[model samples]
Target chain A: MSDEKKLAIIATKGTLDWGYPPFILASTAAALGYETQVFFTFYGLQLVRKKLDLKVSPLGNPGMPMPMGMDKWFPVLGTALPGMESVMSSMMKKKMRDKGVASLQELRDLCFEAEVKMIACQMTVDLFDFNPADFVDGLEFGGAATFFEFAGESDICLFI
Target chain B: MAAFDQELDATGLNCPLPILRAKKTLSGMEAGQVLRIVATDPGSVKDFEAFSKQTGNELLESGEEAGKFVFLLKKA
Candidate 1:
Protein backbone atom coordinates (compact mmCIF):
# COMPACT_ATOMS: atom_id res chain seq x y z
CA MET A 1 0.00 0.00 0.00
CA SER A 2 1.12 3.57 -0.63
CA ASP A 3 2.42 5.29 2.47
CA GLU A 4 0.02 8.21 2.10
CA LYS A 5 -2.42 7.85 5.01
CA LYS A 6 -6.14 8.58 4.76
CA LEU A 7 -8.61 10.60 6.81
CA ALA A 8 -12.33 9.86 6.79
CA ILE A 9 -14.75 12.21 8.49
CA ILE A 10 -18.44 11.52 9.15
CA ALA A 11 -20.17 14.87 9.35
CA THR A 12 -23.51 14.58 11.15
CA LYS A 13 -23.96 17.97 12.79
CA GLY A 14 -25.66 20.71 10.70
CA THR A 15 -25.33 23.82 12.80
CA LEU A 16 -23.10 26.68 11.65
CA ASP A 17 -20.76 26.19 14.58
CA TRP A 18 -20.66 22.47 13.88
CA GLY A 19 -19.95 23.08 10.19
CA TYR A 20 -16.47 24.47 10.86
CA PRO A 21 -14.90 21.34 12.34
CA PRO A 22 -15.43 18.96 9.43
CA PHE A 23 -14.23 21.33 6.75
CA ILE A 24 -11.33 22.58 8.84
CA LEU A 25 -10.09 19.11 9.65
CA ALA A 26 -10.70 17.80 6.15
CA SER A 27 -8.77 20.61 4.50
CA THR A 28 -5.95 20.40 7.01
CA ALA A 29 -5.62 16.67 6.52
CA ALA A 30 -5.72 17.05 2.74
CA ALA A 31 -3.07 19.76 2.88
CA LEU A 32 -0.86 17.36 4.79
CA GLY A 33 -1.10 15.07 1.74
CA TYR A 34 -3.46 12.64 3.41
CA GLU A 35 -6.29 11.26 1.31
CA THR A 36 -9.30 12.96 2.87
CA GLN A 37 -13.01 12.26 2.54
CA VAL A 38 -15.93 13.95 4.25
CA PHE A 39 -19.24 12.07 4.28
CA PHE A 40 -22.20 14.34 4.85
CA THR A 41 -25.19 12.57 6.34
CA PHE A 42 -28.57 13.49 7.83
CA TYR A 43 -28.45 17.05 9.17
CA GLY A 44 -24.97 17.49 7.81
CA LEU A 45 -26.40 17.55 4.28
CA GLN A 46 -27.23 21.22 4.73
CA LEU A 47 -23.53 22.01 4.52
CA VAL A 48 -23.28 20.71 0.97
CA ARG A 49 -26.59 22.14 -0.21
CA LYS A 50 -26.61 24.86 -2.85
CA LYS A 51 -28.04 27.39 -0.46
CA LEU A 52 -26.74 26.90 3.08
CA ASP A 53 -28.27 28.26 6.25
CA LEU A 54 -26.25 27.59 9.39
CA LYS A 55 -26.91 28.55 13.00
CA VAL A 56 -25.38 27.82 16.37
CA SER A 57 -27.15 26.04 19.24
CA PRO A 58 -26.95 28.26 22.28
CA LEU A 59 -29.74 26.26 23.81
CA GLY A 60 -27.91 23.01 24.40
CA ASN A 61 -24.20 23.65 23.76
CA PRO A 62 -22.74 23.69 27.24
CA GLY A 63 -19.26 24.02 25.85
CA MET A 64 -20.13 27.27 24.13
CA PRO A 65 -21.70 28.78 27.22
CA MET A 66 -23.65 32.02 27.15
CA PRO A 67 -21.87 35.36 26.81
CA MET A 68 -19.88 36.83 29.67
CA GLY A 69 -21.65 38.42 32.68
CA MET A 70 -25.10 37.40 31.36
CA ASP A 71 -24.46 33.68 31.93
CA LYS A 72 -24.44 34.30 35.67
CA TRP A 73 -27.70 36.23 35.80
CA PHE A 74 -29.89 34.82 32.97
CA PRO A 75 -28.51 31.31 32.76
CA VAL A 76 -31.98 29.94 32.05
CA LEU A 77 -33.25 32.85 29.99
CA GLY A 78 -30.19 32.74 27.73
CA THR A 79 -31.50 29.54 26.23
CA ALA A 80 -35.03 30.92 25.91
CA LEU A 81 -34.18 34.22 24.22
CA PRO A 82 -35.68 34.87 20.81
CA GLY A 83 -33.36 34.83 17.78
CA MET A 84 -30.73 33.40 20.06
CA GLU A 85 -29.40 30.95 17.50
CA SER A 86 -28.53 33.66 15.01
CA VAL A 87 -27.08 35.84 17.73
CA MET A 88 -24.94 33.05 19.03
CA SER A 89 -23.90 32.09 15.52
CA SER A 90 -22.79 35.60 14.67
CA MET A 91 -21.05 35.95 17.99
CA MET A 92 -19.27 32.68 17.52
CA LYS A 93 -18.22 33.65 14.01
CA LYS A 94 -16.76 36.86 15.37
CA LYS A 95 -14.93 34.95 18.05
CA MET A 96 -13.45 32.60 15.50
CA ARG A 97 -12.39 35.48 13.28
CA ASP A 98 -10.76 37.23 16.21
CA LYS A 99 -8.82 34.06 16.91
CA GLY A 100 -7.71 33.91 13.24
CA VAL A 101 -9.75 30.79 12.55
CA ALA A 102 -10.65 30.54 8.91
CA SER A 103 -14.34 30.66 7.97
CA LEU A 104 -16.32 27.63 6.79
CA GLN A 105 -16.39 28.92 3.23
CA GLU A 106 -12.63 29.45 3.27
CA LEU A 107 -12.08 25.99 4.66
CA ARG A 108 -14.26 24.49 1.95
CA ASP A 109 -12.21 26.29 -0.65
CA LEU A 110 -9.06 24.95 0.92
CA CYS A 111 -10.52 21.44 0.83
CA PHE A 112 -11.18 21.83 -2.87
CA GLU A 113 -7.73 23.20 -3.52
CA ALA A 114 -6.20 20.42 -1.46
CA GLU A 115 -8.13 17.79 -3.48
CA VAL A 116 -10.14 16.52 -0.53
CA LYS A 117 -13.15 14.44 -1.55
CA MET A 118 -16.55 15.71 -0.47
CA ILE A 119 -19.08 12.90 -0.30
CA ALA A 120 -22.81 13.27 0.20
CA CYS A 121 -24.89 10.47 1.61
CA GLN A 122 -27.21 9.03 -1.05
CA MET A 123 -29.84 8.24 1.54
CA THR A 124 -29.85 11.83 2.68
CA VAL A 125 -29.89 13.09 -0.89
CA ASP A 126 -32.99 11.03 -1.57
CA LEU A 127 -34.55 11.93 1.75
CA PHE A 128 -34.09 15.65 1.13
CA ASP A 129 -34.93 15.42 -2.59
CA PHE A 130 -31.72 17.20 -3.45
CA ASN A 131 -30.24 16.76 -6.90
CA PRO A 132 -26.52 16.30 -7.41
CA ALA A 133 -26.48 19.75 -9.02
CA ASP A 134 -27.55 21.23 -5.69
CA PHE A 135 -24.18 20.67 -4.09
CA VAL A 136 -20.79 22.27 -4.71
CA ASP A 137 -19.07 21.16 -7.89
CA GLY A 138 -17.22 17.80 -7.93
CA LEU A 139 -18.87 16.18 -4.90
CA GLU A 140 -19.33 12.42 -4.81
CA PHE A 141 -22.72 10.90 -3.99
CA GLY A 142 -22.68 7.49 -2.29
CA GLY A 143 -24.17 5.31 0.43
CA ALA A 144 -22.85 3.76 3.63
CA ALA A 145 -20.70 1.24 1.79
CA THR A 146 -18.71 3.92 0.02
CA PHE A 147 -18.17 5.76 3.27
CA PHE A 148 -17.18 2.52 4.99
CA GLU A 149 -14.56 1.86 2.35
CA PHE A 150 -12.90 5.17 3.10
CA ALA A 151 -13.38 4.87 6.84
CA GLY A 152 -12.02 1.35 6.87
CA GLU A 153 -8.83 2.44 5.18
CA SER A 154 -8.38 5.68 7.03
CA ASP A 155 -5.67 6.14 9.64
CA ILE A 156 -7.83 8.82 11.21
CA CYS A 157 -11.62 8.63 11.34
CA LEU A 158 -13.69 11.39 12.86
CA PHE A 159 -17.36 12.19 13.46
CA ILE A 160 -18.05 15.93 13.32
CA MET B 1 21.13 34.46 -3.27
CA ALA B 2 18.87 31.81 -1.74
CA ALA B 3 20.40 30.14 1.31
CA PHE B 4 18.33 27.03 0.63
CA ASP B 5 16.79 25.64 -2.55
CA GLN B 6 13.42 26.92 -1.29
CA GLU B 7 12.33 28.94 1.70
CA LEU B 8 8.87 29.33 3.24
CA ASP B 9 7.98 31.82 5.96
CA ALA B 10 5.26 30.04 7.90
CA THR B 11 5.42 32.33 10.90
CA GLY B 12 2.08 33.06 12.67
CA LEU B 13 0.61 29.90 11.19
CA ASN B 14 -0.58 27.14 13.53
CA CYS B 15 -0.51 23.37 13.52
CA PRO B 16 -1.27 21.57 10.27
CA LEU B 17 -0.97 24.80 8.30
CA PRO B 18 2.79 24.86 8.72
CA ILE B 19 3.15 21.19 7.90
CA LEU B 20 0.54 21.31 5.11
CA ARG B 21 2.15 24.25 3.39
CA ALA B 22 5.52 22.65 3.79
CA LYS B 23 4.28 19.44 2.21
CA LYS B 24 2.77 21.32 -0.71
CA THR B 25 5.89 23.38 -1.28
CA LEU B 26 8.10 20.33 -1.05
CA SER B 27 5.99 18.48 -3.58
CA GLY B 28 6.86 21.09 -6.20
CA MET B 29 10.58 20.80 -5.52
CA GLU B 30 13.07 18.27 -6.79
CA ALA B 31 13.79 15.26 -4.64
CA GLY B 32 16.82 15.66 -2.30
CA GLN B 33 16.31 19.46 -2.31
CA VAL B 34 16.38 21.30 1.00
CA LEU B 35 13.58 23.60 2.29
CA ARG B 36 13.91 26.26 4.94
CA ILE B 37 10.85 27.16 6.99
CA VAL B 38 10.05 29.52 9.87
CA ALA B 39 7.06 29.09 12.15
CA THR B 40 5.84 30.23 15.56
CA ASP B 41 3.67 27.27 16.60
CA PRO B 42 5.09 25.70 19.73
CA GLY B 43 3.63 22.33 18.76
CA SER B 44 5.69 22.31 15.55
CA VAL B 45 8.49 20.36 17.22
CA LYS B 46 6.23 17.32 17.56
CA ASP B 47 4.17 18.05 14.47
CA PHE B 48 7.25 18.17 12.25
CA GLU B 49 8.47 14.94 13.81
CA ALA B 50 5.26 13.12 12.90
CA PHE B 51 5.07 14.78 9.49
CA SER B 52 8.61 13.85 8.49
CA LYS B 53 8.13 10.33 9.81
CA GLN B 54 4.78 9.77 8.07
CA THR B 55 5.94 11.26 4.76
CA GLY B 56 9.40 9.68 4.85
CA ASN B 57 11.11 13.04 4.55
CA GLU B 58 14.27 13.90 6.45
CA LEU B 59 14.28 16.58 9.11
CA LEU B 60 17.83 17.71 8.67
CA GLU B 61 17.76 20.39 11.35
CA SER B 62 15.24 22.21 13.58
CA GLY B 63 15.48 24.76 16.37
CA GLU B 64 14.06 28.01 17.70
CA GLU B 65 15.53 31.43 16.94
CA ALA B 66 14.17 34.90 17.74
CA GLY B 67 10.87 33.39 18.92
CA LYS B 68 10.43 31.60 15.61
CA PHE B 69 10.72 27.86 15.10
CA VAL B 70 13.06 27.09 12.23
CA PHE B 71 13.21 23.87 10.29
CA LEU B 72 15.27 22.47 7.45
CA LEU B 73 13.94 19.47 5.56
CA LYS B 74 15.23 17.29 2.77
CA LYS B 75 12.54 15.65 0.66
CA ALA B 76 12.66 11.89 0.34
Candidate 2:
Protein backbone atom coordinates (compact mmCIF):
# COMPACT_ATOMS: atom_id res chain seq x y z
CA MET A 1 0.00 0.00 0.00
CA SER A 2 1.17 3.52 -0.75
CA ASP A 3 1.60 6.11 2.00
CA GLU A 4 -1.33 8.22 0.89
CA LYS A 5 -2.20 9.34 4.44
CA LYS A 6 -5.82 8.25 4.08
CA LEU A 7 -7.66 5.76 6.30
CA ALA A 8 -10.98 4.00 5.79
CA ILE A 9 -12.32 2.31 8.92
CA ILE A 10 -15.17 -0.20 8.78
CA ALA A 11 -16.83 -0.37 12.18
CA THR A 12 -18.99 -3.47 12.52
CA LYS A 13 -19.21 -3.91 16.27
CA GLY A 14 -21.08 -1.74 18.81
CA THR A 15 -19.88 -2.84 22.22
CA LEU A 16 -18.02 -0.27 24.31
CA ASP A 17 -14.80 -2.23 23.88
CA TRP A 18 -15.22 -2.25 20.10
CA GLY A 19 -16.51 1.32 19.95
CA TYR A 20 -13.25 2.97 20.97
CA PRO A 21 -11.08 1.67 18.17
CA PRO A 22 -12.93 3.25 15.24
CA PHE A 23 -13.48 6.65 16.85
CA ILE A 24 -10.04 6.62 18.45
CA LEU A 25 -8.30 5.66 15.24
CA ALA A 26 -10.41 8.01 13.17
CA SER A 27 -9.65 11.01 15.39
CA THR A 28 -5.99 10.07 15.56
CA ALA A 29 -5.78 9.75 11.79
CA ALA A 30 -7.34 13.19 11.40
CA ALA A 31 -4.91 14.63 13.93
CA LEU A 32 -2.07 13.18 11.88
CA GLY A 33 -3.47 14.97 8.82
CA TYR A 34 -4.94 11.90 7.16
CA GLU A 35 -8.23 11.97 5.31
CA THR A 36 -10.23 9.72 7.63
CA GLN A 37 -13.67 8.17 7.17
CA VAL A 38 -15.42 5.71 9.46
CA PHE A 39 -18.36 3.70 8.16
CA PHE A 40 -20.63 2.14 10.78
CA THR A 41 -22.44 -1.00 9.67
CA PHE A 42 -24.30 -4.06 10.94
CA TYR A 43 -24.36 -4.07 14.74
CA GLY A 44 -22.29 -0.89 14.75
CA LEU A 45 -25.44 1.16 14.20
CA GLN A 46 -25.88 1.65 17.94
CA LEU A 47 -22.94 4.03 18.09
CA VAL A 48 -24.58 6.57 15.79
CA ARG A 49 -27.70 6.62 17.91
CA LYS A 50 -28.15 9.56 20.28
CA LYS A 51 -27.03 8.64 23.77
CA LEU A 52 -27.76 4.92 23.85
CA ASP A 53 -24.52 4.83 25.90
CA LEU A 54 -23.81 1.14 25.33
CA LYS A 55 -21.99 -1.01 27.84
CA VAL A 56 -19.26 -3.62 27.65
CA SER A 57 -19.99 -7.36 27.84
CA PRO A 58 -17.09 -8.97 29.62
CA LEU A 59 -18.43 -12.42 28.72
CA GLY A 60 -17.69 -11.98 25.05
CA ASN A 61 -14.88 -9.40 25.07
CA PRO A 62 -11.51 -10.80 26.08
CA GLY A 63 -9.50 -7.67 25.41
CA MET A 64 -11.17 -5.71 28.20
CA PRO A 65 -8.88 -5.88 31.20
CA MET A 66 -10.26 -7.80 34.14
CA PRO A 67 -11.58 -5.20 36.56
CA MET A 68 -9.19 -4.45 39.41
CA GLY A 69 -8.84 -7.48 41.73
CA MET A 70 -11.08 -9.62 39.54
CA ASP A 71 -9.97 -13.09 38.52
CA LYS A 72 -8.40 -13.75 35.15
CA TRP A 73 -11.40 -15.92 34.24
CA PHE A 74 -13.70 -12.93 34.63
CA PRO A 75 -15.84 -14.10 31.74
CA VAL A 76 -16.48 -17.36 33.52
CA LEU A 77 -17.36 -15.41 36.63
CA GLY A 78 -19.68 -13.25 34.49
CA THR A 79 -21.18 -16.40 32.95
CA ALA A 80 -21.91 -17.73 36.41
CA LEU A 81 -23.68 -14.50 37.29
CA PRO A 82 -26.41 -12.50 35.54
CA GLY A 83 -26.14 -8.75 34.77
CA MET A 84 -22.35 -9.03 35.09
CA GLU A 85 -21.95 -7.18 31.83
CA SER A 86 -23.37 -3.98 33.33
CA VAL A 87 -21.06 -4.34 36.30
CA MET A 88 -18.09 -4.90 34.02
CA SER A 89 -19.11 -1.99 31.85
CA SER A 90 -19.38 0.45 34.76
CA MET A 91 -16.07 -0.59 36.25
CA MET A 92 -14.38 -0.30 32.89
CA LYS A 93 -15.84 3.18 32.34
CA LYS A 94 -14.76 4.28 35.79
CA LYS A 95 -11.25 2.97 35.22
CA MET A 96 -11.02 4.65 31.86
CA ARG A 97 -12.36 7.95 33.19
CA ASP A 98 -9.98 7.88 36.16
CA LYS A 99 -7.08 7.15 33.85
CA GLY A 100 -7.80 10.31 31.78
CA VAL A 101 -8.69 8.37 28.70
CA ALA A 102 -11.32 10.23 26.69
CA SER A 103 -14.79 8.75 26.95
CA LEU A 104 -16.49 7.31 23.87
CA GLN A 105 -18.72 10.36 23.55
CA GLU A 106 -15.74 12.66 23.98
CA LEU A 107 -13.85 10.82 21.28
CA ARG A 108 -16.85 10.93 18.98
CA ASP A 109 -17.17 14.67 19.51
CA LEU A 110 -13.49 15.07 18.82
CA CYS A 111 -13.97 13.18 15.58
CA PHE A 112 -16.67 15.62 14.59
CA GLU A 113 -14.44 18.56 15.49
CA ALA A 114 -11.68 17.00 13.42
CA GLU A 115 -14.01 16.82 10.42
CA VAL A 116 -13.69 13.08 9.93
CA LYS A 117 -16.51 11.90 7.69
CA MET A 118 -18.95 9.56 9.45
CA ILE A 119 -21.21 7.33 7.37
CA ALA A 120 -24.12 5.18 8.52
CA CYS A 121 -25.05 2.11 6.53
CA GLN A 122 -28.40 2.65 4.78
CA MET A 123 -29.50 -0.98 4.98
CA THR A 124 -28.77 -1.23 8.67
CA VAL A 125 -30.49 2.08 9.45
CA ASP A 126 -33.56 1.00 7.50
CA LEU A 127 -33.55 -2.41 9.10
CA PHE A 128 -33.23 -0.90 12.57
CA ASP A 129 -35.97 1.67 11.99
CA PHE A 130 -33.68 4.58 12.71
CA ASN A 131 -34.24 7.89 11.00
CA PRO A 132 -31.61 10.50 10.21
CA ALA A 133 -32.98 12.52 13.10
CA ASP A 134 -32.03 9.69 15.43
CA PHE A 135 -28.39 10.57 14.78
CA VAL A 136 -26.45 13.78 15.15
CA ASP A 137 -25.94 16.12 12.26
CA GLY A 138 -23.09 16.17 9.70
CA LEU A 139 -23.40 12.46 8.81
CA GLU A 140 -23.65 10.86 5.39
CA PHE A 141 -26.13 8.03 4.75
CA GLY A 142 -25.39 5.31 2.21
CA GLY A 143 -24.97 1.61 1.72
CA ALA A 144 -21.91 -0.53 0.87
CA ALA A 145 -21.25 1.43 -2.28
CA THR A 146 -20.54 4.56 -0.25
CA PHE A 147 -18.06 2.71 1.91
CA PHE A 148 -16.46 1.07 -1.11
CA GLU A 149 -16.02 4.46 -2.78
CA PHE A 150 -14.12 5.71 0.27
CA ALA A 151 -12.06 2.51 0.71
CA GLY A 152 -11.04 2.47 -2.93
CA GLU A 153 -9.15 5.75 -2.62
CA SER A 154 -7.52 5.18 0.75
CA ASP A 155 -4.06 3.84 1.49
CA ILE A 156 -5.14 2.10 4.69
CA CYS A 157 -8.42 0.29 5.20
CA LEU A 158 -9.05 -1.03 8.70
CA PHE A 159 -11.88 -3.37 9.67
CA ILE A 160 -12.52 -3.06 13.38
CA MET B 1 11.12 21.48 30.50
CA ALA B 2 13.45 21.41 27.57
CA ALA B 3 13.75 24.49 25.37
CA PHE B 4 10.86 24.17 23.00
CA ASP B 5 8.86 26.55 20.92
CA GLN B 6 5.70 24.92 22.25
CA GLU B 7 4.95 22.50 25.06
CA LEU B 8 2.08 20.07 25.41
CA ASP B 9 1.49 18.44 28.76
CA ALA B 10 -0.24 15.23 27.78
CA THR B 11 0.43 13.77 31.18
CA GLY B 12 -2.19 11.32 32.50
CA LEU B 13 -3.72 10.74 29.09
CA ASN B 14 -3.36 7.33 27.50
CA CYS B 15 -2.46 5.98 24.04
CA PRO B 16 -4.09 7.94 21.25
CA LEU B 17 -5.05 10.97 23.33
CA PRO B 18 -1.47 12.08 23.85
CA ILE B 19 -0.65 11.67 20.18
CA LEU B 20 -3.83 13.40 19.14
CA ARG B 21 -3.13 16.34 21.43
CA ALA B 22 0.40 16.60 20.19
CA LYS B 23 -0.81 16.59 16.60
CA LYS B 24 -3.32 19.33 17.41
CA THR B 25 -0.64 21.42 19.07
CA LEU B 26 1.80 20.99 16.24
CA SER B 27 -0.73 21.82 13.57
CA GLY B 28 -0.71 25.48 14.55
CA MET B 29 3.07 25.69 14.74
CA GLU B 30 5.32 26.73 11.90
CA ALA B 31 7.80 24.44 10.24
CA GLY B 32 10.97 23.59 12.22
CA GLN B 33 9.39 24.54 15.52
CA VAL B 34 10.20 22.13 18.31
CA LEU B 35 7.41 20.81 20.50
CA ARG B 36 7.91 19.06 23.79
CA ILE B 37 5.14 16.72 24.87
CA VAL B 38 5.01 14.95 28.20
CA ALA B 39 3.02 11.74 28.15
CA THR B 40 2.36 9.18 30.86
CA ASP B 41 1.34 6.41 28.48
CA PRO B 42 4.11 3.86 27.94
CA GLY B 43 2.95 3.23 24.37
CA SER B 44 3.73 6.80 23.28
CA VAL B 45 7.37 6.03 22.61
CA LYS B 46 6.62 3.77 19.70
CA ASP B 47 3.48 5.67 18.76
CA PHE B 48 5.35 8.94 18.33
CA GLU B 49 8.01 7.19 16.32
CA ALA B 50 5.48 5.80 13.89
CA PHE B 51 3.54 9.05 13.81
CA SER B 52 6.60 11.07 12.92
CA LYS B 53 7.54 8.58 10.24
CA GLN B 54 4.10 8.57 8.71
CA THR B 55 3.54 12.32 8.90
CA GLY B 56 7.07 13.34 7.87
CA ASN B 57 7.61 15.16 11.15
CA GLU B 58 10.97 14.88 12.85
CA LEU B 59 11.50 13.27 16.23
CA LEU B 60 14.56 14.99 17.60
CA GLU B 61 14.67 13.19 20.92
CA SER B 62 12.60 10.94 23.17
CA GLY B 63 13.24 9.62 26.65
CA GLU B 64 11.67 8.81 29.95
CA GLU B 65 12.50 11.18 32.72
CA ALA B 66 10.97 11.27 36.20
CA GLY B 67 8.53 8.49 35.29
CA LYS B 68 7.09 10.32 32.31
CA PHE B 69 7.82 9.92 28.61
CA VAL B 70 9.11 13.08 26.92
CA PHE B 71 9.04 13.62 23.20
CA LEU B 72 10.64 16.36 21.10
CA LEU B 73 9.02 16.76 17.70
CA LYS B 74 9.80 19.27 15.00
CA LYS B 75 7.04 20.23 12.66
CA ALA B 76 7.93 19.00 9.20
Worst 10 residues of 2 chain A by lDDT: A71-80
Q: What class would a CAPRI assessor give candidate 1's docking?
A: acceptable
Worst 10 residues of 1 chain A by lDDT: A61-70
Q: If you score just chain A, what TM-score does every candidate get?
A: 0.90, 0.88
Q: Tens digits of per-residue lDDT for model 1 on A1-160?
A: 4678899999998888789889878876776668999999999988887677778876765666666855677676567688877777888888776654666776677788888998999998898787878788878889999999879988999988
Assess each prediction's global lDDT (C-alpha) against the native. 0.82, 0.86
Give every collision pair in model 2. Answer: none
TM-score of each: 0.84, 0.89
| Residue B46 alpha-carbon offset, candidate 2, angstroms | 1.2
